[model samples]
Target: MTTYFLDRGGRMTLPGNKFHLRVDGAGGRVAIDVTHRDHQGLSSGRRDRATVSRITQRTIIAAVPGDGAPVFRDGARVALFIESDDEHGSEPLTVEVVQQDVGATFRAELARLTPVGNRIELSVRAPDQLSPRALAAFRTAHELLGARTRPHAVADEIDIAIDTTASMAARLTDGSIPALADLIAGVSRAAGCDLRDVRLLGPLADSIAAEPLGTLADRVAAVVGETGVGIGRSTGVAESGNGDDVVLVVTDAPPVERLDTGPGVRHLVLSEEPIAADAPAQTGIVPAHLTATAVTAPTVPDQDAATLRHLVRGLLAALAARA
Candidate 1:
């Protein structure tokens, strides 16, 4: 059987088979475009569009169609087959999913993919905000996509803020808070920032206020331990981000929508993960953004530096303009 498949399981496509893909935000899921085009003179016999299914040699005789005919979901396991003219026992043509390769997808989207230190660290806020089913999905995905990574180091006295609202710590493991705190501490050390200099603003004011920088091994631990309240109400942290050197916002997107930043506060938003849907952004707060392989990429596939840069570009530009 003549078959072609897109490696990486992250992207699926059919090239010579005439199935072009467009990853668009149609509903709330990643939408794939499947256009059927006729290539004249390629074959004398009529090209009938047969069912798309994955079949093993053992079960070739009685394989059922895999999924939806017209609309196919991303990362789905399926195949396309054109009925062969041969008098064989079963249809001979079988094709596999050709989604883009993970590396190819990254290379196309990123102008440059700098190596991030091994590990992808993320702390979820407002666990209460997500439903049980949604949280489970997030956990599965999170487990798959582990700690942040990059070989580089930072030593600047930049500050980071996390919104640890109700049950947000639930997103991570049992003792993740301490581990996350330690990771931030390592990052702060790389940036050469004292624990006190690395301000950590969060909803738990009482907890943070109770901890002192001297008591912690590093600035990250100090901030993570301390508690502060409100998005715009941090006592020392200016909403406009005035004196703050560098600010990173670790929270889900929506509630932080109206978050204020400073004139020069280059910001990094570690969102809880934008709604996982190809659907248009339904929230009035977030305008629709289409991520296609054709245009400049919205998020680099696997590159952290480029991806982070893309995420904060607009915010940084605006703040820089004011600065």
Candidate 2:
């Protein structure tokens, strides 16, 4: 018999119409109605079910019944079947399974990072594992922000600050292009801004001619492909200057100096990985009298472009909300 392992948030895709519910080895069919009480006497919703499946070791056949297809929703409950090797007088074992919705969990994190009401600013810190998801949620929040500013004249422009250093070569080849492309798409869609308006700062600025904001996105992609230059080690700021409500900083490492802040410059930090716990304290050039918000995206998965896009969308939403 082959043993299958399922963790708290593990998932298994069902091929066709074989099964009605996804199953997990650990938690039996997850339900949506369960709530957990925390230390503060407050109850919060926790994972109801985990979704997963097992494939036969020898044949690689899915262990689900009925054509082996998936038939469950994001939070459906399921069952596990254990077949006995010995046919005669054998005892059968069955267990319950649950499905967990990763998308839902990601949205919840985004909600926590967003602030409510007019002109409120907030910062976010996301674990590297969740950065992509967090960024996608941020983009969603951006649309919501636009909705809030309907009466007031909101600016569609954003100033982007990127780090340029020699080490960026690896990130440029590996992940930065895709990540930036996703960001450009998300910003364009969420803020109703033309792609051409998105500008590249520094030496790269001269290499690519500034075109109509509508064409800026394509130009940026082309530049990324040709030069293969990644956001280097330098740190700069990206601001939607109209209201000074958002500032985005993309860097592989921490800033050498603290950011300068004004009424509207809400600080956000995006990194390829988490800052080391024992790193020395940041000093110098702190933005005077303005609170800063930071968000990080450390690892962009090599095999998951869709997830990466979703993450970028989230970041855009979050920034839009602030605007």
Candidate 3:
């Protein structure tokens, strides 16, 4: 058996012997292409055709016929195979099976790291072993064929808005608070942004004695324990009119009537259950556009946590890309 490594646009030819194949990658998924051609020259008039009879994760079976007569089965392994034979059987007849490796493992790893619901901006460095053209194709696939997300500038700052209300207690207890804190750190590092400059915002009312907004910001700071600006009482934050600012609001269902502002806030509702549609507006918070993202609490299933993490990461990525 002959083993061939495929580049972005490489091709392979197969001998008539039966063959076996195996593919390994991070996601364990690969794309396969198969084509067949006919050889010239024959002794009696004959038309040649090849048929792929079976396909699986690791194997392919095909039948190649000569002169449109009896069919001969050819077994092949690997992701894809091509079959063809010489009409006259004089040119050392054989079939060509091409295998191209698209770096599914690398793509899967990237996907794992990518957050769901967010735009992804990819910066791919060519592997030393691969050519520039191959890398370019890989990048094209990532940008065009894969999930779509906007790309952001590497050095841009991301403003994170938090919702500090009685509702946040659930997130704090459910583990979403810490998980979100870690996510923020990862995003800050990946985007080359200054986590120190990150802004935290929440709701505040003179009626609340404990200053839940301030306390929430402190909790977020303690969870991240990183230097960043904390702003409570939404109206108190300096209005810079900076389009670069990203407002991430963490909240539970609050009545819209309670909200006193809505110009620059985006909502991240954390709960084991979905937020109600008529949930009250967070008081004194104005979001330019309110985008609702969900984070899973401890009460959520493990699978849901994974799903929510992926989604939140994607959302953050998208927000970062916008910057």
TM-score of each: 0.28, 0.34, 0.33
Model 2, position 228, has a per-residue lDDT of 43
Count of backbone collisions within predicted model 1:
44
Instruction: Write the candidate numbers in order of decreasing TM-score.
Output: 2, 3, 1
Candidate 2 lDDT by residue in tens digits, 246-313: 43444444445754343233223334344454443211111110111122453333434444444444
The TM-score, computed over Cα atoms with residue i paired to residue i, of candidate 1 is 0.28
lDDT of 1 by residue, 1-323 (tens): 56443222222222121211123221222222111111011111112232222211111111111221222232323222222222324434433323221110100110001112321111111102222222222222222222223211221234445445443344222333333333333333222233333344444443232123223323333444444234343444524343424444443342434434454243333333444443221111111111111112333344433332232233222122221
Return model 1's CA RMSD, one decimal. Answer: 19.9
lDDT against the true structure, per candidate, is 0.28, 0.32, 0.32
Error of 3 at 108 (Å): 18
- Those runs of model 2 whose alpha carbons end farther than 4 Å from true positions after fitting are 1-155, 191-196, 201-204, 207-218, 225-241, 244-247, 260-272, 275-313, 321-323
Cα lDDT over the full model 2:
0.32
Candidate with more favorable, higher TM-score: 1 or 2: 2
Ranking by lDDT: 2, 3, 1
Q: What clash count goes with each model? A: 44, 56, 36
